[model samples]
Target: MTELSHEGERLQKVLAAAGVASRRVSEQLIAAGRVTVNGVVVTELGSRVDPLVDKVAVDGSAVQLDPDKRYVMLNKPTGVLSSMSDERGRPDLRAFTAEYPERLFNVGRLDSDTSGLLLLTNDGELAHVLAHPSFGVTKTYIATVTGTATPATMRRLEAGLELDDGPIAADRARVVGEPSRGRSIVEVTLHSGRNRIVRRMLDAVGLPVVELVRRQFGPLHLGTLGVGRTRDLTRVELGQLLTLSREPGRPRSGIGAPDAAGTAMDDDESDSE
Candidate 1:
């Protein structure tokens, strides 16, 4: 067994960089004695290892440094779970991503009922940063509500609403077009990632959401990506996202807003109850 060396990276970090898990989870695995370094079980959180020289294995499976990182965007369809697998064996992204060799997880979640752009990647650090609320990464959604949005309601949405969980507010909210009869299209933007936040916020204001679709996340926009399809983010798109995640409160440009007519209801899939 190789002795802990100051020159090498920490064991948890090495595990995270190897895509085993996030740094915190990796520490738990180490504490559980599931990780072995140089054929010796390492249960210490402070242990270090040289990736090039030390053989690391988790659950007796050798961990290899994954050099080919993937960043993919999936137009998540309604009725499909956001998770990689469902305990009840319901549909999930696994069916869509089965062909890809690299194991990837969603950066943030979109409820099974909602659909839009969802990012998947094997880069744990980037995923952590993007998902953290402190980063202030903006998410844009177009909601089809059952009632027309009045100017007063728009003001209230911007000011903030007291949901069951806590106080929440949208950064921006606007009516997409003239309300026809009872239904209206609303555009909302906010940095909060609370579960079903968009739906909850509208519900707080008496406007129940009929359909919701996330059009943009940070600097990446779901431009013309058909439902149930997945594609790689462009190099420029990935670079901008990384920059946005690293530096919070930095102003980003050219994040296109959702078209007024292209609301979630436009999709062919039926909304889940």
Candidate 2:
């Protein structure tokens, strides 16, 4: 765990800046008596703090500032939801986190049944910024379809299809390697994180997706990473990812951004849970 910031600030303010959550959420922790300064529960709304030297605990654990951020890349397995703890008690990414001492959360979600590269981190603000829809950190996937999707299918995907809700499209769609008999391995890269957008798009065209495995997200790629295995994010990789837009208080600008009526990032963004 990193040391708490010694900088002059309120305990709650430091926690929020450390990415524990937003400032408003931090206040709630204080109200619930979850925050403590120097070993005493602090219910005061305006308690001052010095993260650098004072010990602050939230729910009995220290909230420290880590000068060096930690980033993890995991080849998430199918059937486990993307969460810190699962009420259903089903298997999750926590299986490989024994060595990680700091509290962590998913960078983005992968569907319970979709297996692919997943990011986990202790830095709250980085996760929030990366998960923000405006970033559109493009992701790539290799999907097996139920039926043959010829050059025409490729064009259809490129042209984008209309769904019951709205139009869905792929940023780049190409056949991987040579198409096998009755099966075509296709590589799809998209910036929009819509719910099952790939499957839905093909389904609408009568080429339902059978198996989907993500190969890349932003600058991170699965490559030969074995399924269910986890790895550390290289400094270079993390640096590249940080270049993504983290525009605050507004949705990302583009056709990929959801409609005016929409509330959250589109559907494809979730593959884990």
Candidate 3:
């Protein structure tokens, strides 16, 4: 792009800006012989693009800057895997997107078995920032545990538990709801993006998270949005998120953790890795 100056820019940046894939992922698409410039395979990372004149294609569809970016929040039900596509032919988010005009990918993730709030977007840069651990987006979840969590256990969790990866700590946890009568419900909130951190955290303290549901992430909440449905975020909502991205007080980890479990929707966490 620097070389082009008054002419074409590099292809990878253009694709990333177009909400296709991350720059790294775009490079893979280019190298795998999936991308072409002006109908010619341009596998070279140095391939430049003249957006005004040259056409880029991936899998035969022309890639260009979409006029409008889509950012949606969905109450994802269980069964959908966290992937753009599934090789095993399992059902995915595409089923809920029949009316969508542009292709969008999930922002964070909801594992195949879990269900709850999921963000889908065509803005790769925003996705990159939002999903980055450094941003420390707090996620609130209601987890069904095998047994009641005692004060000592809660204190241990808040202070930090010794996990294989490291001492896993939560910002908050408390049980204040009813579910199935005898069993206690707890709500937990944390900012880290460790693999199955919520489930793992509960497991280490002798409380197994039987069912995990993410009710909130950062500035967004799983309000009245029904399961399997979605809606776009307002501009102001997006502005708040952007503002959060610029804040420093929000630690990279432990930014938000609620201590309790109840009244939260399940979510797919398979994509967290």
* Per-model TM values vs. the true structure: 0.67, 0.67, 0.65
Candidate 1 TM-score over all chains jointly: 0.67
Superposed Cα deviation of residue 65, candidate 3 (Å): 14
lDDT against the true structure, per candidate, is: 0.75, 0.68, 0.69
Model 2, total clashes: 15
What lDDT score is found at residue 221 in candidate 3? 88
lDDT by residue (tens digit), candidate 1, 1-273: 346677788999998997778999999999998988866899988888877566677776666544576889999998887767665887777877787898777776777888998888776556666665555678889999999798789899999998888999999999898888799999999988676778888989989998889899888999999999999877567656654554535333322222221111111122232
Model 3 spans with C-alpha error above 4 angstroms: 1-67, 178-180, 247-268, 271-273
Model 2 spans with C-alpha error above 4 angstroms: 1-68, 245-273
Q: Which is superior by TM-score, 1 or 3?
A: 1
> Lowest summed-lDDT stretch of 10 residues in model 1?
261-270
Model 3 C-alpha lDDT versus the unseen true structure: 0.69
lDDT, candidate 1, at 58: 78
- Report the lDDT tens digits of candidate 3 across residue range 1-273: 123334567788888886668999999998888887655777877877876456566655555444466778888887776566665787777776667886677766677767788887665555666776666678888888888777777788889988898877899987756546446678888887777788888888878877777889788888889988889876545545645653444334432211121001123254542
